[model samples]
Target: MALIILAHPNFDKSFANKTIIEALENSKLDLEIRNIHDLYPDFKINAKAEQEALLRHQTIVFQYPFYWYSMPAILKQWFDIVFEYQFAYGSKGDKLKNKNFVPSFTVGSSESSYTALGFQHFRVYEFCKHLEQTAYHTQMNYIDPIYFHGTSLAAGYTPDSIMTNAKHHAQKLIATLSQLQ
Candidate 1:
């Protein structure tokens, strides 16, 4: 089964992330979705429960919006709490070893803005070093990330267009999940 850690702060107000999630719900794959914001609105993450969930699944998917070139604050907090030293890295911390790590996200900026010559000044994958290293540290397989750029209204993407793109992203993600199975 696949476990999706959804970390959107404003889920109700989301366009792309919400659509993608809806699609995934309809995909019928064996999935356990944990919407961290809703699950821990007080930011009090239950490490034991989270770790238990992790142990139940082979594929771990981090689904969110790309915020400040990283994940939402809640996810970072979850990682800090759930991925404890002796639980994720040190000796006797092999519970997560060999799990699949997949990052699925939506970006507000256009793809061109992520280039060296563009405003962001780095490629998308260049920004994923932290994630890649996290997978390595946990002995997890780092699958290539699935992302959709130009998802913001400010970037001139209409709701319909974003939804269409989100559906496509969901299909691609579903396929990836199937491959894992």
Candidate 2:
């Protein structure tokens, strides 16, 4: 199975991510989509359960709607609590050593604005560095992220079109997962 850690706090309001996740959860992708906020409303993650969830899958995806240049707080806690030192980074932390970690995110703006000359003044990668580093520390293979950059700015962001793109992304991910397998 592929562990999909979904961290969209405003999932209900997201026209894009919601469609994406819904397709992922209901499809034949061998996925487990965990809504961080719904699982731990008080910011309390069950370490044992979280670790087990990680161990159960070969590929892990940190799926979220980008917020203020970072992920949601619940995802931060998910990392802190689930990715323990001894199990994920320490000398004995070989559980995730060869696993594949993918960070899938959606942005509210267009792709052009993420360039150095754009209004954001930084590349899309600058915001994703922390996640890359985190995966490296755990010895996981960090794949290039799956991004829907202009969803919010896209025309209407209708369910049909968003779902279409999401299905394509998921299919691409499935191919990537096959390579890892």
Candidate 3:
């Protein structure tokens, strides 16, 4: 089973990420999703609890809206504290060995805009290096990320569009989990 980690800082204010989470909650993906904003509103993460959750699953999917080419702040903090010595890295640390780490995110800009010749001046993979490298360090198989781009000005985007894409993304995420399993 895959554990979908929800890390949107303001999920209530979000149109894309929120719908995606809702879709996963309704699906049968064997998901153990944790909303960072709700779980650690004050940023005090339960280390033991988080680690135990990690132990229970073989795949980890970080679902968040791309912020400044990375994940939301709380997720980065989760990585810093949760993935520590003797637990996620080093000779004794192998909690994530052979596990899959997939990053599924929403980007306001178009995929093309994340290229060298594009506005962002960096490829999506290049921007996601940190996530991939972290997975590598912990011996996790980094999977190709799923991205929803150009949604801000996607034209005709409405509540229906949000729900449709959310369900679609959720199904795709589940498909990826099935492959890993």
Candidate 4:
């Protein structure tokens, strides 16, 4: 099964991420979804519960909107606290070994912005290298992420276009999970 840890601070304000999550729920996939922001409103992460959740699933997904070219503050906090020395790393931290890590995120900027000559000056995967390294250090398989770009300035996308993209996102996610199994 896949465990998706949604970390959007302002989930209601997101059009792309909201639609993508809805599509995932409608799909018949063996997965659990946890909106961390809703669960930990006070920014206090339940480390024991979170670590237990990670242990129950083979594929772990961090789904959220790209904020300032990185994950949301809440998710960062979760990583800082959840991935502790004795649990996720260090000598006895083999809990996450052989697990899969998939990061599904939405980028507000257009795809062109993530280029050598573009404003961001790097590809999406380049920005996500930290995540890959984390997976490696923890002995997990870091699958390439599913990305949805241009949400902030998606002027050309109609309602039908948006829904179509969301459906595609869900399909891709399901396929990714199945392959991992």
Worst 10 residues of 4 by lDDT: 153-162
Q: After superposition, how far is residue 128 of candidate 4 from its true place, in Å?
A: 0.7
RMSD to the native, candidate 4?
1.6
Q: How would the candidate models be sorted by TM-score, starting from the highest?
A: 1, 4, 3, 2
Q: Going through the candidates in order, what is the number of backbone clashes in each?
A: 0, 0, 0, 0
lDDT of 4 by residue, 43-140 (tens): 99999999999999999989998888789999999999899998999999989999999999888777888898998998888889889999999999
What is the C-alpha local distance difference test score of each model? 0.94, 0.81, 0.84, 0.87
Total backbone clashes of candidate 1, pairs 3 or more residues apart or in separate chains: 0
lDDT of 2 by residue, 73-99 (tens): 888888989899789989898889888
TM-score of 3: 0.91
Q: TM per model?
A: 0.98, 0.88, 0.91, 0.94
* Model 4 pairs in collision: none
Model 1 residue runs over 4 Å out of place are none
lDDT of 3 by residue, 52-130 (tens): 9999999899999888888889999999889999999998999889988999998877777888899999988888888
Q: Residue by residue across 1-181, what tens digits does model 1's lDDT show?
A: 9999999999999999999999989888999999999999999999999999999999999999999999899999999999998788889887889999999999999999999999999988898999999999988899999998988998789999999999999999999999998
Candidate 1 TM-score to native: 0.98
> Which stretches in model 3 have alpha-carbon errors above 4 Å?
153-163
